[model samples]
Target chain A: MTTSPTERNGWSGDGALTDMAASVPKAARKTSRLAGPASTAEQWPEFEAVAQPQLQGAAVRRLAGRRSNNGVGSSNSSSSANIGNNPSKRRWPRVVLIVAAALVVVALLLVAFAACSISRGESSFEGLMANAVIETGANAVSYDEGKTVYYNGHTYVLNEDMVSVLVIGIDRKESAAEDKPVQADAVIVVALDKKTGQATAISIPRDSMVEIGRYADGGYAGVETAQLCLSYGYGDGYETSCEYTTTAVSRTLYNMPINYYFTMDQAGIGPMNDAIGGVTLTPLQTIPKTQIVEGQETTLLGTDAYNYLRWRDKTVLTSSLDRQDRQIQYVKAFAKKTLGAAKSDPGLALSLYNQVSSYSITNMGMDEFSYLASVVMGGNITGLDVISLPGEMVQGEKYAEFYLDKTAVYETILDVYYTQVD
Target chain B: MTSEQPPTTSNPDPKVPVVRKYRRTIAALTVLLVVLLLSASGGIGWLIWEHNQREKAAQELAETPIPTVEQPVASTPDTPEVALPDNPIDFASIQQTSPDVYAWIYIPGTPINYPVVQHPNDDFFYIDHNPERNYAFEGSIFTEMANSLDFSDPITVIYGHNMHDETMFSTLHYFEDADFFAENDEMIIYTPGHILTYRIISAYQYDNRHILNSYDFSNPEVLADYQEYVRNPDSLLVNTRDVPLTSTDKIVQLSTCMTVQNWNRYLVNGVLIDDHLTN
Candidate 1:
């Protein structure tokens, strides 16, 4: 089983020594004998001198290791030559190299996977709005109005373009029901031109004189002509009050027909604000009445902005007209913030739409409203003109009266409503 | 070789000593080689498995999708069949479900589709809960929950509720940082066809009631005075470029409640830039 030393080191009896010796230069052939076993001091110099050249040459050759040769060798040239002929030993290094390469490939793939997972978790505006809509229960309103309003012996079909909308701000403090009739704190008249997509808004002062629409119910029938419009009616029936009020106001002030109405109460504001995140508003002066109200507390995500708006008494407002102007300020502020927020986050916009739809009573259907939304969203309209009704106190024998300045109101409306666009 | 030796017990296997030494050396070398080979193979295998895991994780990460940023539209289409009339207001088309609970505001630049909830109890809109039955789009605008349009005082304060989705005035922070405001200065507001363009004169974030007297908008003189105060250089987010504001100017004030402090208000001041009709 065991071969002689010569056979073990080399494949043949001649081994690789004879061949290596022959390959050496003739002058260096003497160095071969010097490599022989001779442990003696006197022979050391001779052996070193002769063997130095051959040893140096062998070292250089070994340093230039080629991957194909596997570079497995010893100082003994015979043994190296014999081992180099064996193909099985050479294949060992190739297996190791292949395994290393496979490991590298696997590592790269895992890295790629981890990177993808991290990127997917980021959230955006549109998604947030979608979630918000689900959270705030707002639905689309249908646009089917069974009847049309007759104006000047001509029936006016209820459409988005040629509609007059009355935007009412109601003060609903006592009743918890969403449909309860609340007193109107603010009133705005909006007329839309369907063909042009142009709108005219006229702010109606709360103190203006007008005959309340006679209702079968005792609540609004006897209300004073000067009281706010919402102090008299509720729900679908409120349309009559809007019709009568629109007629009287139009005749008494702008001499125009009123068509549509939109009413909002206290319950719906929070979600709308939450939907857009929040709106930014700049005040003309500093308001100091910052008391926390009942049922309203500050949270990490929610803050009480209503108290700031309600801080009227402490703000040194000189007149009711001043308060009306402040209301306009709030509206403009809301407009800028909401529009800007919607641009970045569609989900928030959708959420706000959903929330508002729930508590609102509007004549516009979902489809018609979407068209209007597209126009507003697509075009820029930050410079819209806003005008308020003119009013003055009238001295009477029995009661002090506030009368609407008909000429001023009409002039303001005409200017806003009759603009030519190029 | 045939020398006569002392008669001692002689064993036939006399070469056993040399054979035993050689065998021991060979066995030790074999053991070392085998152990080295086993360890190397195991090391390579572990490295390969680890690398594969990492690659898989990276691949999964690459496959994830990022959310889109824009306004949302109604799933249904808006066509002429559902259109409202051209003249006289259509009361029936615009339903008032909760009178005073919510109202619809149409701004030309806004993506609001449905009626927005009117938060009478609070001055601003709630970003979390949707006002039931209202147009609860993600970024629908909300007005001051309780502020009035009183122009009699020095400043008329209006407040809007901000949302995390950046729907309302979440972008208002862009103004708080100086560089952002420089690029954006104009916005358009639409009420039906009444278009109003506003110019951002200055923007500032303040603690709630920092300038207490400026919220009154009733007095024209007071309003002018409040504008001056807001234009002061010391304000947190204001530009003191001497932007002129007058009583004749119909200014728009936008306010939002912030979580910075319990009562802190973040206000964005803008002036009426211009007004024009689209159609």
Candidate 2:
């Protein structure tokens, strides 16, 4: 095929041809490859399909080839085929980029999955397991009964896992000498059941006759059966005093072991009560007004509370046992308040612990304090059974004394300290 | 047959499979690197968190007020007073928190100062429970309910886990060394009204036995015979100090798991040399 000279010259002239050539530059027209044939109009669509990216360059070269005045439609059609199927086409780069992005997304998903699986549960504190409870009795006997109990003889025998705490409020007006036994004003034993959160608080009257190991001038003078409260007077310091008091209480209570003891003086008692923001008292009976009112809902500050605790108005409620009832009520309320306060601010227990350091003494460690605080906060405190040894008030050589109802006290302790489970 | 000499500057044509192999190798390396990087970061982060938690607990314990439970009086009647922890806490309040608090056991040289509680009827519960009364792998130091709470028994055995972290009875192993037993021999047991002191006399490895359950300590003859056995123990027993073992001297045994056998336990025996009533 060939193009007529007139036709080729006219299409390739400096003057624009028909409509398409008008936009073409003079240099482009001279170099145009499409100029090889007058049939370019018929093949224009095919060339445009593959030459879009190098449109201007390919168009100029195509036109220039035909500008030689030769007709070649077959050649132009074949050129478009090769360019369309070329592997180096810009399309390959887009495919490569897509593959890289997909790889990155998959890696990120793997990382996320690993992270989710590796994260630990919020409640999982492995250290707590070492410092706390060991789940036992599950594989041992009495699976139906809780771990803290053993079913024996139709009654759940509490493992003498019994934690008996003796609480003492000392009546020493001045610093006691090493050998002087200062009597405790109030003595109470709070026994807790390890299995069930039952607490039995038994208060011993001051005048009950029980053998207390006497400490004389830095030496123990064997056992002397004296007023129960006089046990505190056997030792000059806190240790001896507390020990004798504890021993006396133990002896009076059927020799039940007292696990730990706490002694507080008037100063410590008041501050400790106030530390928990004062305890509210509601008197059940009418009495004379003093630092704390008798019948109304009166809040006692530390000092006022202390005065109320030790107040033994001989005229009204002549027995010291009457003072015990008041002490029991005050202790319960104070414990509740302290626990509630500690729940909000655990530091409160520590602060109170420090406050009582100088004037008070106890065998309890902070580990014990923290555990008690948690138990109180957890509301496990149940069976706040408060009782005193059933006794008769009698006259002594100098002061009035109370004779403990021994059989009754024994029965009460057995009931309060142990419960039957079938 | 189809090929003429290729360009000298170029090498052989890479097959489709070969190109694919190179791409796979690069991806695998990238994946491995990412995993390693993540593991290093996560592991280091966890370690820091754990250390911080332990530090906080140690600080709190150090500051926990130590009551003047141990009297300042020296060992002898006329000896000078020594500095002692004097802060006392209300045990009733503590029992409120943890009913497990049965007694406070303290040994001066080791981390044995802790609240001891008997497992409810189960001598083995402390093998799993912590001081918080929670099931833990490193259990708390505990005693069986068979023992008298007043320390009146001829033989009372306390148990703890042999944790590698040197917690609980793990430190009790120090008694196996004769010098450790001699230098730090005193073991103080505190109750509501008493400060009882014991001197470490013997330590050795022993097998598991329901000790108090196995024998009756109530009989005077049985109690006397057992004291003889403890005084003249097996060849493995290391006797650090010799004090006359009488029927009256109550002995407290500290036991922990031993590595020699699963059923083997290391025991430290202390004789009640002094039973003083400290208020």
Candidate 3:
């Protein structure tokens, strides 16, 4: 009561002002006219000059509007009218902009993370009937996503989801340059059904006479009937070579689409053998150039793996046919070991892929490979059926040629790549 | 129970200083924001600059002048074989660039035409170092200390980086293709007085274990086993020729790293096919 009117309202008074405000040349007094007991009109002019630099345009204007209406001290009516123009009015837009910017940053990070997770230089192969299905016949019945046909009294549908990989064993020796065309010594088409967890491998002998596209000077010349293995020699020796072999095989097997190709040269046998921690098998035949006795169980390791897969008596014309039988046996054992190892250590397949990548070429992406590996690792696959093409080997000109049984090829393709509609 | 009421929303102290109260905190926050922004930008900028510099250096090194082979004089049935002229590569001039240059290797159908250098002191000095003795990720083609300079070793393992730009030994992958491996076979190494030609027998991926360190080449049994492995590598990705390899044959192995597996190496195995004297 003893203090002046200016001092009572905390203007130019040390007792009323905080230490922070007292430190400034001219302090900004925060006044809520509606909430406070009373703030005089005389105090506002000084407040405007000192706080104008810090206050937003809207806040400053609101304060200025209040000063004009204020005439009497403790004017409740004037303060009540200005309450709608509080600091929160300006804060809404700023909070919205901040939230929008935060969301944009989060979206960008998510996109970048997804991009990084995808494997580089790997592409998923699109199946031929990925979207469109072939018309079977008037007696066609649709089953799920597949088209069905009445085949020999059984309603069969093309299992479009079956993942087929063509496995080729090349027969080019280290000293193999003089040979005119490289041969696919052992050719096997491995197909797996993810839904049923069933796997089937069909081994086609190298000498099977099939239609092969001919190329001279890297350009397609014409299609000629040649031994099935010679199809691999027409391309650039990597992807193109693999493609030619796949196409030849597809044509040979009722034109069923093959999703992938895996080729192993004679060199990859030993490391691949050790990768599965050595495959133990009783030799079906006495393998030449090695001490492996027929009907004796031997754990093939290092160079022994090479000899077991590659040994053939060149003098015998049907030596290749004999060799194919041995290869089929080896493959069955190898697959069993690989699937078993993968079950215990899920990373075994990818690690093996990486190890053999130098010695092998594959079109499989990491995602597709992992998915296939996971299916195998899930312990869902209990049995693998390997079938050799029913054919007769006849010595043709200089090499042995195997003429495939057409009816058998047709039925095998249906059995391996098709599902029962019922 | 004794209770105290919370402060009401109305009548907040009107005398409180708004701007002066948070000035120190505001200044500190602004400084932290600026520092974070600058360092993030600086790190990204440095990475981009380094990548650009590496590319530029690779381009400059690839333009180095290399010697081309002189076509041999045609031989009639009466003559033994085509008579090759004197060595075209000036060993004297190449030695001037670096005395460590002992031989130049050229593979037909591949860009692997470069001088082979062996550091007198450090075995890996040329692995990440260019021929000009500058730091380069695309290092010069080199051989280790275990082999002889005369190309007389039973097995010589030459090493190079599989550069992303497909320089150095990257083109060696062309042999992985069955067709390319069949069509192309010869790899020539030209020393000061001798032109040694090797017939490529096999090209495939092998484990990363040091070949020289793992095996004793002097042992005939080991050489036989190795030759057999080379002839019949169990890898699915192999290209082999019909040429035969024996303990009497000298072989050269061109080695490079695989893209995915650091623990594996791609090897192009070759056996000595011919040796011609050059002035």
Best by DockQ: 2
lDDT of 3 by residue, A1-422 (tens): 01111211101211111101111111122222222111321221111112222333344345334333322211222233233454533443344344334333433443333343222111223233231222222432211222344557788776756777788887566427765667677899988775566789999999999867666665544456789988888866666777778767866775455667788787888898898888899997887678798999999998888888888887888888888888888888988888876666655776777677677766665445655655555546755689999988888898888999987887887788777776
List model 1 lDDT by residue over A51-112, tens digit each.
33344345434423322232222112212223234553344445435533443343343343
Model 2 TM-score on a 0 to 1 scale: 0.39
Docking class of 1: incorrect
Whole-model alpha-carbon lDDT for candidate 1: 0.41
Model 1 alpha-carbon miss at residue B13, Å? 99
* DockQ for every prediction shown: 0.01, 0.02, 0.01
- What tens digits encode model 2's per-residue C-alpha lDDT throughout A177-196? 44444678788888765445
- Give candidates' CA RMSD values in order: 36.1, 33.5, 26.8
lDDT of 2 at A129: 10
After superposing candidate 2, which stretches have Cα over 4 Å from the reference?
A: A1-156, A174-181, A284-291, A314-317, A382-384, B1-279
Give the alpha carbon lDDT tens digit for every residue of B188-211 in model 3.
999988889999999976544356
Error of 1 at A352 (Å): 2.4
